[model samples]
Target chain A: MTTTLDMTALDLRQVNTRLQAAARAQANEDYVITNPRGSHAMACGLDGPLGVTIKGSTGYYCAGMNKEATITVEGSAGPGVAENMMSGTVTIHGDASQYAGATGHGGLLNIKGNASSRCGISMKGIDIVVHGNIGHMSAFMAQKGNLVVLGDAGDALGDSIYEARLFVRGSVKSLGADCIEKEMRPEHLETLAALLDKAGADARPEEFRRYGSARKLYNFNIDHADEY
Target chain B: MCGIVGLFLKKDDLRPRLGDMLTDMLITMTDRGPDSAGIAIYGDAEAGRTKITVQSEDPARAFADLDAAVSEALGQPVTLTVVDTHAVLIVPDDRVAEATALLEDRGLRVMGSGASMEIYKEVGLPRDVAARFGLRQMGGSHGIGHTRMATESAVTTMGAHPFSTAPDQCLVHNGSLSNHNQMRRRLAKKGVFTRSENDTEVGAAYISSRIAEGASLGEALDGTIRDLDGFFTFVMGTRTGFGVVRDPIACKPAVMAETDDYVAFASEYRAFADLPGIEAARVWEPEPATVYFWER
Candidate 1:
């Protein structure tokens, strides 16, 4: 059965408590939330395979630390959406503000519109796909993840990146230190194709340029001290 | 962090509710900034008259003979209305400068002076400050507010936001300016004087000086992106319009909504949720280094 929660009448704590109780019960139910109206920390810290659909925009830290729930925002989201998420899927129908999907461990975060600055900072393991432009300093200090952008990237894309793979279809303003454009081989194309398919994006795989760490700053080599 | 809000009504039907709506929006952002709060309201202007809003530590003693003294000094009729620690002095338009100087010499610090605008600010919670000023009961065509957390300055009444250094112009900022000291000196050279040590006042003076030099509001905001350093999201009010601009980095959060009746800006979306017909408004984030202004 599907449950409906109207945030206009219910407080955020009560809604989160209900979601947590439902997760503990392992109920195979879906939830529909309406009239969110920019309340922060909605549907956060869930660890079940439930389905949730929010009808309107949300504020900071929405759907954070998710384990196995699928959450969808019908409108835009504020900062830190799906932050530190693990093993789930979060989709935004509209734009996302700064620090979207920051430091997620394992999950799929898809944004249909543009994402603001620091899209995936300090991400351990997550797959982020954006259909529109991303702002400056995205993927900063990202350890392990896959970031795919169909539109242009702002300044300082993937600065101080490590292990994470980045793909951009449009021009990059500038690359961060130790982050460089790598040769897009057939395997990389296959990986990009899979990511695009999972994100339900229409862009072709071959149109993207791959980027990753150059391993020059991995171990603090004395030979590269001058560049530092 | 700080919270900034502005409302410019395009329809006459919503003018009476301007203060009520702006008070609700400012209170919603109490979590972002809880140290101090301020607001500037642009009421209807009367012909051949101008107003100066001043704040004093002791309103009872400072405003007792203010109207009589200023009227005698300027040789014209003057009126003073006291609201808590703030008082508005209405005088003849021709003697506005002389009246302002007289009030300052009598130890009253002018908050704002214009044909339409009046400013009130204090060091307290936004809800308390709004209540103290009876903001919900006042009426205006356009207004702007700020809730400050005391990042770069002390938590004092003079340090609160809605900094106005020019007539009919005031600015509220949500971020810091890295080069305000140097910029303050530059504006001083150009004959724009700033009162407080607050960086936001410098920003206001910069824009006012630029406008004095024949640059439009949009052009002055564009100049800020080139000359000013650091993160900022500024919402300013003039006699007829409201303008918003963000820095090139855009580290500060800002959201705007526009409908048939009004144009509103806030630090987040919660401030717009309770407005009339907000569900149908076109809500969006202002782009970096771009100016958005609305005039009636």
Candidate 2:
């Protein structure tokens, strides 16, 4: 069974209890948390097929630790929204605060406007798509997964960039360690297009650029000794 | 503890008085290391011949020793002129090691070392260090710098990082050593000279010595992944570009920011805040026992 909670009469605590109760009753049940103004931690840590729809703005840590649920935020969200989320779809109509979807393990995060710094910081398997400009240090030492930025990137775009696919459509002020601009091949173009589509952005994939490691500094050389 | 700053020619086109950038950056970080400063301004590669700047506690005596050592090692009667606390030596690329070893062997403090090729560092802060060294006058394509909060080892020029860990390799470390003593003993057996008691020096030595034995920088880094005992975040720059790694389990903090202006990684995000436009900045923490590699 699906449960709809009108957050106008209920606080985040009640909404959470209802979502948990719904999860206990039906594993596949979805919860729609509605409120005109954004609140904080509206729907978090819900597991199974529990879908969450927040109709307005929300405070920090909304949809955190989520598993398998599809969460949609009608308006903006505060810091650490969807942080360390396991598996789910978190869609935000407006912008997000710092550390959005940080250290996420899996699932997809779609930010419509833009995200602040430490967005998807230390992401593992999750795929994040930012339609607008992103803040500084987008992906520092990210181990795996893909981050698609449709707009210009901030300073230190991928400082000490790891094995993550970073695609930026607009100007990239600077690039991080081992990150170099590469020729966008047909295969890469297709991949970026899909990411944009998933993020609901209007940008064409060709407008962006691809960056990764050059692999030259991976090894040391005496002939290149003077080079360091 | 000290702060370091340098400016590499990010722009492809050559400009006049490029050393001024290093001077500017070094000035910004002067409060980080104020004891003594040095700079070695490198010329364009096509121009040929690398200029080296070095500093020492015993200024006049160190220069004399450096001059005699260079003459003896190269057998070419090299000229060493003392400019304040620094001694300027212009030489070809390959001769750097024999020259450095000879200088160190003769008891020269060797505060900061560099060439038209790359800059090497030891303990000191930014501004006065830059003014004393005059870095804003050189030019190059790529550069790497460091800021240190020294722990466990005596803070001195030698204890400072960006050590010439190998022939042309230099490294900066941010962590404590758990098994520094053992590692030092192991490297010593292989004829790698152990300079200071600092664990980071061992790491630099390990990387350089491994590369000297034909190991790739990445492979050497991976090699140390198993052998070295510590929680650390480290960055090393070679003529090749830049390379960084974190311990399998993070024992320290490191952040990377990429923007339209430049890609910068530091121990804190407060470092990259002012850049103009960017999609976003993200911070990540390495998992326990995870390794990452980046080259430029």
Candidate 3:
């Protein structure tokens, strides 16, 4: 069975509480929200196997600190759509604003349209897949994650990256410090294929070029101190 | 962060609703900026005549017999219309310099002087300021509004946005500039004087000086990305056109929507929710470091 909540009538607190109660009781039922109208902090801090769908656009921090629950946004989203998520899936049907998924530890965030700057800054084991272009300085200081961009990336893509992999099917304007192009071997192709399958994206794995950390700035060497 | 709203009507039928739509768009971002508010309206232009909009804290004394005084000083007839703290003084186009000098000598602060553009601004919530100026009643072909949160300058009426540095030219800015002081000194050497400590004033002055030097609006905006150092989103209005540009880094947020009847810009998408024909309008974020302009 599915539960429906109208945000126009019930406040955010009540809706969040209902979702939390369902999560606490281990309920597997699906939930649908209506009339979001750019409201922030929807379906946040969830730790359940249930599914949640938002019918309209949302404001800042729409789904921060999520775990296990599957969340989907039917319309566009404001800044920080899925910051610091820990598992499960979150998807956006339309465009997303700046800092879409900053500093997340786990889970997959898929955006169907364009995403603004800093799409995955300071990430720790999160997979972000975008069907369209991403803005500048994306994946800055990222650690242990995979980012897939199907369209062109803005200036300074993957600045100062650490142990993270970036795959782009389109042209890159510029690469940031300590980030450089790498060879896409068969293993990377298999990994990207699995990720694309999991996200239900329709891109070919062979079309992407890989980029990663250069390992030149990992240690404080006197010869490389000037580059800092 | 600050909020900026601009509406440029392509069709003549939408001119009467310009102010009402602009006000609604500006007030939607009250939470983004609540310290002060301002607006610039470009109404119909009259041949061989221009108007100067001035604001005074002591309107009762400053505006007393002001029309006769200016008329006598310029040796020509002048018309004055007061709306709360603001008053528009109309004079012959040739006497604009003489009239502005006279008003400055009389200790009056000139907000903006041009044939078509009239600027109004103060330190307060946007809703209150809009009400005081009867924003909904005013009509024009195009207009721009700003709700400011003072981060780089003192909170005074002079520090408010929609800074007009040259005749019929105005600019509103969101985000800070890193090299304004250097640019201000450079522009000062080139005979462009800025009136306020606000960095946005320096940007306005830069554009005005460029246009005065015979550079097109697009050329001036292209120069901004090269010369101006910082994260900024600028919405500039001229007598006959409207322009928008963002910095190379594009740290600031800006969205634009266009329809057959008009073009609109705001800091976010929510500002366009109530606009007429918005559901059918083509909306997208303005590209970083690109200039978007439209003219009548």
Candidate 4:
């Protein structure tokens, strides 16, 4: 069954409580939230295979710490959207603000519009795909993940990156410290094609470049001490 | 963190509702800052008259017969309007400097002075500050407000935002400047000074100094990206309009919305949710290190 939750009538706490209860019970129901109006932290910490949809724009930290719920925002999302997710799919039909998917263990974050600065800072094991451009300092100190951007990237892409793989189809303003463009092998192409397909992106995987950590800063080197 | 909101009316029909709209936007951002709140409104200007907004700890004593004293000193008619601890004194345009000096001599803190801008700020909640100033009833072409979290300054009336270092111009900032003290000394050498120890005041002074040097609003804001250190999302107001700029890093959150009638800027999208025709307005986050301004 489909459940309609009106934010104007119910407070955020109550809405979250109901959604959490349903997810905990593994109800596997569909929820539609209306009148979000840029409130923060909505539909967070869902653990069941439930379907959730937010009708409008949301504020900071929306859909954070998701486990197994598929949440979709019909409008834009604020900073840190889908942050720290474990396993699930969180799709934003509009732009996302800063740090859209920071420090996630696992999940798929699909953004149809642009994402601002720090798009995937310190990400561990999440997969993020953006259909538009991303801002500066994206994937900073990221440990493990896959970030695919179909459009241009701002300055300092993948600074201090480790393990994580970055695929950008457009120009990068500047590569971050210890990060460089590498040849896109067949496996990388296959991975990008899968992610792009899963995210419903229309672009071909062949027209992209891969960037990753150069591993120079992995250890404390005395020779590069002056750069710090 | 601090919250900044600005509204510039593109249509005259929306001018009367500027304060009402801006008040709602500011109050909605009360959670971002609870230490102090301030607003600078660009209202009507009478010919040959200038407004000097002043604040006093003891309004009853400091404002009593104040206009009479200033009128006698300037040999002209001066009008005084008091709202809570703040008051606006209207004097002839030529005597703005003399009037400001006299007010300072009387222990009154000059918030700002301009032909059309009247700044009112206090160390209280945004709702209370707006109510005390009757912000909803006031009309303006453009206005800017700040809900301060007090990162780089004390929680005092003099330290509140919308700092107007030059006439018909004011600025509100959402982030702290890392090098304000150094900039303050540099501006002090050039005779540009600030009354409070607030870093935002130094930013305002910097912009005002640039404008004083014949820089346009866009050029002055561009200079901030080049010279000012640290993160900032500034919305500045002038006699004709307002401008917005963010640091190159843009760590500070800023959202702007525009329609046929107005252009609104805030630290978040929620502030713009209540604006008229907001659903249809073209909303977008401004690019970092870019200056965007609108003037009628």
DockQ of candidate 3 compared with the true complex: 0.41
Q: lDDT tens string, model 2, A1-228? A: 456788668876888887766655556776677653435576787776677777766666888988888889877676688998888799998777677888888888999877866677777777889888777677766666778888888666766666777888888877766677888899888978887787778888888888765655556767977866
Q: Write the per-residue lDDT of candidate 4 for residues B70-130, one digit (tens) a residue.
A: 9899998899999899999999899999999999999999999999999999999999999
- Model 1, DockQ value? 0.66
- CA lDDT, every model vs. true structure: 0.91, 0.65, 0.90, 0.93
Clashing pairs in 4: none
The candidates' DockQ values read 0.66, 0.03, 0.41, 0.72
Compute the interface RMSD for candidate 4: 0.7
Best by DockQ: 4
In candidate 3, which residue pairs get closer than 3 Å at backbone N, Cα or C atoms, i.e. clash? none
Docking class of 4: medium
lDDT of 1 at A82: 98
Q: Which candidate do you rate higher for DockQ, 2 or 3?
A: 3
Local accuracy of candidate 4 as per-residue lDDT tens digits, A1-228: 999999999999999999999999999999999999899999998988889999989999999999999999988999999999998999999899999999988989999999999999999999999999999999999999899999999999999999999999999999999999998999999999999999999899999999999999888999877988
Q: Measured by TM-score, how close is model 1 to the native structure? A: 0.94
**Worst lDDT 10-window in candidate 3 chain A:** A34-43
Off by over 4 Å in 1: A219-228
TM-score of each: 0.94, 0.51, 0.94, 0.97
Which candidate wins on TM-score? 4
TM-score of chain A of each: 0.96, 0.86, 0.97, 0.98
Task: List clashing residue pairs in candidate 1.
Answer: none
Selected candidate, larger DockQ, 1 vs 4: 4
